[model samples]
Target: MRARFVSATPSEPAPPPRDGRQSAAALLVARGTRRLLRRLDFASVTELPLLSGRRADIVALSAGAELLIVEVKSSVADYRADHKWRDYRAHCDQLYFAVPASMPLDIMPQDAGLIVADAYGAAILREAPRHKVAPATRRAVVTRFAQAAAHRLHALSDPDAAGAEAF
Candidate 1:
């Protein structure tokens, strides 16, 4: 599927568009990525298939000859603890983690792909890395993920809707 996401830096307080304002880190990475991708000639799909999982966040896929998955992270703990992030590698031929530009990329695994982004653009810090995932408990995890994703998608598609009415 084509990912359809774009990141733009915020200029003024209460910017013209809500989407232009990204979290501090995302802003950095988005900016960083944009500058880097200038040399490449390819399109990117934004907010692509956001899988259902324990730590589901926005994912963007590269629109090109090859399949690429980019996972965006906003928190340090989430950076450390996103379980199904490992599973993402299974579905896609290429997988990567995207984060804010200023944050140190030192701690990230040397073999795992990385994207450093800021509000203006993004840059690929690392690429062509290896990821390890064990298959033992993935079935159960995927099942739970499917259910949660279905519910979350429903909520997003219908913002005015509410769950079973809190009483």
Candidate 2:
């Protein structure tokens, strides 16, 4: 399923599960990472679809218009099983791996940024190297991100509205 960003509020119902396959630890990391990103003045969405048919665990847009893609790895096996993260580099200005504190830091690739997170918050252990995305690709990704965020907000406001499931 495609990803949609949902805002949480006191009166609103909780958002649906992002992905049933995600481990509890991974969810904690994602939550903390999102909080950290917001603190850094970046707007982020989870499970955003990419042009390459891959779903990014988190996509953040900075105030300066830089895009970042973060892949959450809950375990060593999870990281080893997935090699698609390499493709994400082409879609963002920076690529990072977010993991729980229990995960071994050395197992992650040194080229990408590293983030250690828990349920409360996260810390960026290493900064990701800048990689300029093509103007065309940047335009497309930003468009998709905007559309998804808008759709999710609309859905939350009017759940019964037509095309709510489009995102």
Candidate 3:
């Protein structure tokens, strides 16, 4: 995804559009993930680029340096269309599927963790089994996440820096 700066004032600027504005359900999932992860003391970055050329909906890092990736499915159609979610597991210690409470959880892959979310909050219905990532892989993911966050923050001030791609 590409971002363009739209400055409303010389001293203040709006954040770049995120994935060109997420779908309603996706927005809820993101907000809920933030809320939940915060309680667990996990810092998260959204729309994280992965090694497989796919973007994780949310990538979180815990105090112990454990990595978790969550893929948000907004609807039945969204869930059905994706087959690449498995690719996310290779990049993180644990993987999860996050969806609105109304979504049919039964259809989600049993091996992945499950999160039932609303616009306000989320609850982990199942814990994902950890498959520890190699140290080299962990370093790569952490570097990507850090660079993405830094670039976005820099864009907020220098706007022109928004052109730097995270991947």
Candidate 4:
């Protein structure tokens, strides 16, 4: 499914609750991964689109052909609740997990990469999405990244953004 953002004055009408913690976590992973990727000379973006039926949290592209998807979890419950994260297999070339700063460094999938991070900082302890990711999916990632990047860049350029600096 596709998701869009909407904004309205609170006095006009309270729209809907966008309690997209799942989507938020996905974006967090993307944010954290982008930080990690930059160290490796890569550009990263969050909320990469999917091919009709799938969605990815974070999408990162190295200067090389490298690509990655990161899934961030705020709680253990969140992690256990998602057992089929493997299904993301069809979409990303790499699968990774981003955990809260307080989470233990262990217990993550040994084969899969791990990124310890919070809202501000991220460290790449490991890098493993899956063994393989489709080429088309990689393109979808790039397209989504481009779109998200443009939106953020535009917002940052706006004078009304108020102290918001580009990351």
Question: Per-candidate TM vs. native?
Answer: 0.50, 0.89, 0.85, 0.65
Residue lDDT tens for model 4, 65-162? 57776776766777778765666666667788888766666767786788887545688777674566667766766666676567566554462564
Worst 10 residues of 4 by lDDT: 13-22
- Please state the error at residue 51 of candidate 2 in Å: 0.8
Instruction: Please identify which of the two predictions, 1 or 2, would achieve the higher TM-score against the true structure.
Output: 2
How much is 71 displaced in model 1, in angstroms?
1.3
Highest lDDT: give the candidate number. Answer: 2
Q: Least accurate stretch of 10 residues (summed lDDT) in model 2?
A: 12-21
Estimate the Cα RMSD of every predicted model relative to the unseen true structure: 9.6, 5.3, 5.5, 9.5
- Tens-digit per-residue lDDT, 1-167, candidate 3: 89966555866634334766478778877788778988989988888888778888899998888999999889999899888899898899999999998898899999999999887889999999899998998999999988888877676657555475442
Q: How close is candidate 4 to the true structure, as a TM-score?
A: 0.65
Best to worst by lDDT, what's the order? Answer: 2, 3, 4, 1
Candidate 2 wrongly placed segments (more than 4 Å) = 1-8, 11-17
Candidate 1 residue spans exceeding 4 A from truth: 1-24, 27-39, 50-64, 130-167
How far does residue 131 in candidate 1 sit from its true spot (Å)?
9.6
List clash counts for every candidate, in order: 27, 0, 0, 3
Cα lDDT of model 4 overall? 0.63
